[model samples]
Target: MQANIRHQVSPYLVFFLIYNSQVGVGILSFQRTIAAKAGYDAWIGVLAAGCIVQVFIWVMYKLLGKANGDIIDVHTNIFGNVLGKFISFFIMIYYWLASVSVLIAFIEIIQVWMFPTMPSWILSTLILFSVYYCVSGGFRVIVGMSFLSFIFPQILIIVLFIFPLKIAHFSNLLPIMNHSFMDMADSIKSSIYSIAGTEALLMYYPFIRDPKASKKFAHLGVLFTTFLYTISTIVSFTFFSENQLKTTIWPELSLTKTVTLSFLERFEYLYISMYLIIICALIALFLWCSSRGLKKIFNRKQKYTLLLLCLLSVILCHFNGSFKDMLNKYIIQMNLWIFYCYIPILLLVLSFIKRGKQNDE
Candidate 1:
């Protein structure tokens, strides 16, 4: 069901939702992954990935405009009711897995970097519990949380990068095109997952007041995210040698170690603690999208679906570290296919069907 007037968010809030959702755990280690493929030209890959995501955003808007509803309605409109529900079920599963991936990935970061002795299950339970609380409040609460999440970490985190510039070697980015075109193309493909998550717009599009007016704000959000990622990639490239950059798992976090203050011995500890807000926003958004999809398909209450998905995520988080890694890898691959391939084809099919109906009329 479409959100009522009281529940609908202002179009401008789309800026925060799109931006915050795209900047989660992936950005932390993306430098290493992209650098391994394109060397110092990884920033270019980031820019290219942003452009690609923008095109997908446009396509999604067009499709939603035609359906005049969310993805569940689109499926049911184009396919018969039985097949559409079947397809919608798989989409819900994908959203559920995406939420679980974000949850477990953040827990792993806390275990390794923040508190080595903290058990995964304990943190998982706590995080999912918070997700349950926020999501049960409804769409408006989730939008408020997304807005806070974007504002809190962005300025402080970007400011920390200034310290790294003291040691930066701008020359590292020289011979920028040394890598083959194919190499850069590979890097862009790798960067897709880091840029993934904007697809949540499909689920939430119907909840925006004056959904058409939200387009520019949504584009602005993507542009802002792209700029942030490009700058971070450039800083990471210049701050570390090519070999050093390739070896470092979380280059952005490592860059923080270069900062020092009179009272704080390790600034990254504070940074990581503050970063939990960003991670919480991410988990909450994905969980909300999944539960919303469930509610739409089953015509059930969203709170019940929210409780079910949150508990399911907590259970899955208890698996071994290796299983978590494999799951993350699979989720990224699925995202690449779903956004790049499936959305485009679905758009084409919907357009043709609409055209045929018009001709018949």
Candidate 2:
């Protein structure tokens, strides 16, 4: 059930893969979204959500580790091939649509900031071309892209947070926990969706060279991203007044506006450009999961499946005038329920089934 040795990656790379998957276009605007319900207390909600994600990570590892393969294997072993693939088809489609959602969100950013007149198809096609190239090279290549995404932009982006801190109104976060428990719950809910993509680990479990050894690295990866997000939420909360943050979109990108250099007066442009690495890496990983799942389910060639997905993604983006909002909403709900709710139930059921089989044997 394990992937071939040549196709597997080092255990440590789990950190970068988790990092790449979690950090995407959501980071750009999540502050305002989380703040809407809980006011300044939303950062605490973010930490809470991260805790939930850590628990979910533990669940996924336990489930996938027992199967010793991807979710597809888990499904087939439990449900028989037909019904298992029937259920798994929904998850695969979720992966493909998740990639498209990221694609459209980033494309919207490019249109607004970088290219006002550029067509959606052109941008979608351009980005997917890079994603296809990386993904077609196989899982190792996708992980390589993830590693590059982590190394190149992350440290520099963290340094950029200093610019906003210079003028940050730290008192804006005073009188914390002012929001009601209900409001805090709302904020945590929003934060959970924003910090999603860790569930991508389920599909790629077998590709880890030593899945057991990688468990700590996987938890470490989520721990790192949780802190990254909490720090980002704190920075955004301090830098913008409650009212101002509510009004602004892309507050993280706005923070970059404070960053000025002798060579570069417009740093947000560079910020968006650098984000291509993070965004493309995410798209590549999601599509790899989607296409690989489909290949296994249908016994079809992976290349054909991947190419069809890229084409469908492009077509969806081109016609995305009204569908964008709906797409995001659907994917958000799907990520929350499927990964958080149904996945845990699945783990429970799988444990019972495996135990019963062992007793029978």
Candidate 2 global lDDT: 0.93
User: Among these predicted structures, which one has the highest TM-score?
Assistant: 2
- List model 2 lDDT by residue over 210-234, tens digit each: 9999989988999999999999999
> Model 1, 1-361: lDDT tens per residue?
4668888999999999998789898888999999999999889999999999999889999999899888888899899787897898887888889888888777877887889999878999888888788888888888888898888897777778799999889999998788999999989988888988998998998899988899999999999999989999999999999889768888898988898888898888888888888888888888888888888778899889888887778789889668888998889788888778998899999999999999999
In model 1, the runs with Cα more than 4 Å from the true position are none
TM-score versus the correct structure, for each prediction: 0.97, 0.98
RMSD of each: 1.2, 0.9
Q: For all candidates, what are the clash counts?
A: 0, 0
Candidate maximizing lDDT: 2
